[model samples]
Target: MRLSTNQVFNSHVSSYNKGYAELSKTHQQLTTGVRIQTPADDPVGSARLLQLEQQANLLGQYKANMTDATNSLTQEESILKSMINVAQRARDLAGHAGNGAYNDHNRQAIAAELKQIENELFGLMNSKNASGEYWFSGSQSGIQPYVRNADGTYSYQGDHSQQYLQVATGTQISISDNGFDAFESAKNVSRTETRLDTAGPNGQRLYLSQGTVATQRDFDGGFRAGAPYRLEISGDAATGNISYEVYDKNNVLVPAQDGGVGSYDPTLENPKISFLGVEFTLDAMLKDGESESDYATLLDGHSFEIGMAPDRFATVGSSASAQITDSTVVDADAYAAGFPAGGVTLTYDGAAYQAFAQPGNAPIPSTFDGVSNTLTVAGVEFSFSGAPVAGDQFSISADSQENQNILNTIAQLRQALEQPADGIEGGNLRIREAIATALGNIDSGMMQIESTQAHIGARLNSIDTLTLENESLSVYNASTQSLIRDTDIAEATSRLVLQQTKLEAAQAAFMRVSQLSLFDRM
Candidate 1:
């Protein structure tokens, strides 16, 4: 193969240009601190840099989320801390009121203060976030979660769903929980039977119309004095009537039995009167006499025997005890007489359970606190079901992970506090219970918020590390691109000079060779 001077010069020029370009490019990278000026300079590196940039952007977003989480935790913690203080104040008030030295006026004063605390707590429960959303309103953050009704009861308007915050990849943290979980569900309320009979209760009785006036007597008149005897009533005429009233252990009439005011009947046949649990018929008293006994058949023609009147657990309180209410008063004597001893058995209201006892002699309620379900009399606990009560008072604290944190406990406390001490031994203890429960919840929620903040901080740290790493990778990627495609001005200039000299030299050489050989031979 023949080699031409032009070809040699062309090859050296190209080499020179590339060398100088490489050096200049290295200098430019050192000056600019970035290697990539364009994607064509390093295609693969450019692609990697793009990826790194996207990762960095996402990392920044993660950091922002972490910041938001931190702020939320801080806010929650502050609220919970304030709540703790309020609870403490409430507890102190309850303690002061519990002292036997305090009068109703003192109690009312404490209650007034407590009411203020409650109003403050209500505000806390319905607090809003920076976004104008109610913090404890669950999924209904835009609305006021609680409202005081005309009857002084609270009504919840928020939904029973959680509000979620995306804190990490595929991990959503719930920022709010339904009010029902924390407050609405917890209530210690006095419950009463919806079903009451018109007749006497507990099933005890025996009476019938005798001669002129009905006389209550033993089954045979001459019976063992030890056991209660049964008595019967019989009416001589078909139109004859008889009636009696059932009384409580206190001998108070709970229900009236004046079928008619005053009516005369000699031997009212089967003048039956239902008292206590048993039905007394006069026919039995004159069964042997029949027509002579002035006893005609009654609607049932059955004989009524009156013994210890079965067990007509008569009403103790006023007409109010039949319905559920915090203010319904239980008759002291009637309540006591109805009980095996003189107290009420409790049912769970989903929060704390409470017991009501017959009125005890107004000695001071105990000053000490304990947790036992039964009220002790002479060191013996009367039977009542549910959580133990230490003293007259007991707490049913809320344990919800959502809402105002004190909702359930607060409801329980309020209901118990409003109750009277008559049918409940140591009723004051219940007020204390409510305060204690609210305090416990406040403290717990505060700790939880702090813990959440710490965890969010850790996440922020991870985000920062990721962002820094992405930044470093981006720089390296840019430098690699500079190596692949930057121009070297010094090398390019040197190649131009060499190429010019080579062209002149090649022209001279060709001219000399042609003149010496070709001309002579021709």
Candidate 2:
């Protein structure tokens, strides 16, 4: 088709402009080494490159997390070793206290040392890692695990939540032990006194059984002498110097105040009875079987025995010869296991008990079902043997594993040598064993930490390897993208030179063509 003059000129101009534009773009790429300067340059290549950059950033973050986990685990392991040392020290102190040759003064000095140990242990329990996190407070990384009260007894501030280290893929390791399981709760016993009026004018007397003088109680709801307590009993001087008694916790008689009678009086000078309603076992008493009621002849038979409260667990005696059956009575652990949710309705057979909790419905029951018979309470766990009854009640208060059994023999020997009574023979064997168990736990914890370290190290190593491989892959991918979308510097330079020559020729031709009017030619 024949074209108009304007159309022909515009077409030639478009061709030259297209050639110059391509040449300009090539020159710019040669000036800048990078293939893609912005998204507009090559949309697909730029997106892929951005993705590679994000992956690199993510790899860096993973490395940082690995470092934090490793450091925290290391701190936990160090603390466990320190705890092992403390257990050995405690065994030594117990041995010193047990020495028969030691008098009260000497014992007091030993006790002071024991006190120091307690404080140190408290400090250890409250130990903070480099991150200002608590050592044994479980998941409560910010709070101290134990608090000292004015009453010399320590209160546990930590629960059973075990903190864990996230060192690897799908693997978590416990870094802390609950403090409650480490220390034993002491049993508190006390006494109170009140006048016993003869039951219904029948001259009622408390029934006494043989070898029962050590029973502790609060008489007529008079007063309780348990933990963090003091004894204060009031009496009338009129009842002809009323007879009373005193005792201690655990049904053991306090030697200083045995068969205690008040030495104070309401009106009578120095006529005070310090011991009123003292807990005593119903030992042998003058017998009348059953009695008759006559004020004159009624007081004649005068058979009496001490009454006991149900709350006060009774043991026959502390004598090792008293048979192991009575052992459960003073054993706080046994009571804790056997007692109900409110209080233990101990078996009359006097056998040790294992309390359990009832299964809840659906998910709750499934948690402890036979197929999945694991009870995980903050990582502290126990398995139930049989299905729980409706009223089944597991103990919330139970002796925790102290892990002292892992102590080295050499450390134990040192303790035995320094304080002879702490050795593992004869009556003191139990105490020694307890300390050993704690040490054993330390060993176990250390092994766990070391194992975790290995895992974390492996994971970190993997991260590094994978991250490096990914980096290499990213480089290769980038090179391929550059090939598809990048300008060739050598080819671009050659085109730029050729385009400049053509552009100058086109300019001359255009100038010549514009001057080609008929008048100009004439």
- Across 1-522, the per-residue lDDT of candidate 1 in tens digits comes to 975667766765675576566656655654565667668767886787677666556655655665666567567657755766776676566556556555445556666776787789789768888889987667878989876532344556677787655644566555554555545543221110111122122121222321111222421232212223222222335554543333333334433342211222434433444332222222222223344323233312232222221111212221211212222223335333433343333322334333444344222121112353333322223233334323323211111122333433444445545555433332433344344444444444444444544554565565456556645655675565455545455664565566556555656764674355445878
TM-score of model 2 relative to the true fold? 0.44
- Stretch of 10 with least lDDT, candidate 2: 358-367
Candidate 1 yields a Cα-based lDDT of: 0.45
Q: What alpha-carbon RMSD in Å does predicted model 2 have with respect to the real structure?
A: 21.0
The TM-score of predicted model 1 comes to: 0.42
Question: Please, what is the TM-score per model?
Answer: 0.42, 0.44
lDDT (tens digit, per residue) of candidate 2 on 390-482? 333332322222122222222233333344443222223322332333233333434443453454456556555655654666577566656
